[model samples]
Target: MAAWFLYREGHLFPCYFYQTTGFYCLGCGGSRAVLALMHGNFTDALRYNAFVILLLPFLAYFLLSMLIETICGRRILRRPKLPGWAWICFALVAAAFTILRNLPFMPRL
Candidate 1:
């Protein structure tokens, strides 16, 4: 799992999401954001999607929880979903990120 997470082929997927949908959705910046994160490029990641930079911890926690669940036949404590308020915050943040990144404000990636 770790190897799969870290390995790369230096190739881009078809990105059917963008090609078909025509709207750079919530996760459009994710791949670039993660690549920036791996290279210690905090500014670049934040520029791509500040929410991604901030949510990485929670994401890691969820992944680890899933791994634990698979390894041990039960969830350690039943990973709970974020509260409604957090969902609101996430929506707001994502909206702002998407608007900001897509605009001419971000010209250099």
Candidate 2:
């Protein structure tokens, strides 16, 4: 996957959701976003999918923490524990992004 994105300048897969629904889903721009990120275009990456950019840091932290724990037999970086309120807020934001992106007035990804 990394090599494909590094060498290819376009989407890695077609979005079936968009094809069937005629509307962009939450994951619609994810592939393009990753591709843009691979090319060092942060702005374009965000434009393609802000949600993915936002989640990357948290995901990276969790993955790194897990890998370190496995290799060294110790939890050096504790997994982040988000409060219930934080989770609710994140859910709301994600839902809002989905709704906004699918709206006719909003720009299509």
**TM-score to true structure, per model:** 0.67, 0.85
> Which digits, one per residue and each the tens of the lDDT, describe model 1 over residues 1-109?
4323533642234457778866566676666777777778899888766776788998888989999999998999568878999989878988887676667656644
Q: Model 1 has how many clashing residue pairs? A: 0
- Residue 20 error, candidate 1, Å: 5.5
Off by over 4 Å in 1: 1-7, 11-14, 17-23, 106-108
The whole-model C-alpha lDDT of candidate 1 against the native structure comes to: 0.71
In order, candidate lDDTs are: 0.71, 0.85
On lDDT, the leading prediction is 2
Candidate 1, run of 10 with poorest lDDT = 3-12
After the best TM-score superposition of candidate 2, give how far the Cα of residue 73 lies from its true spot, in angstroms.
2.1
Question: Pairing residues by index, what is the TM-score of model 1?
Answer: 0.67
Off by over 4 Å in 2: 1-9
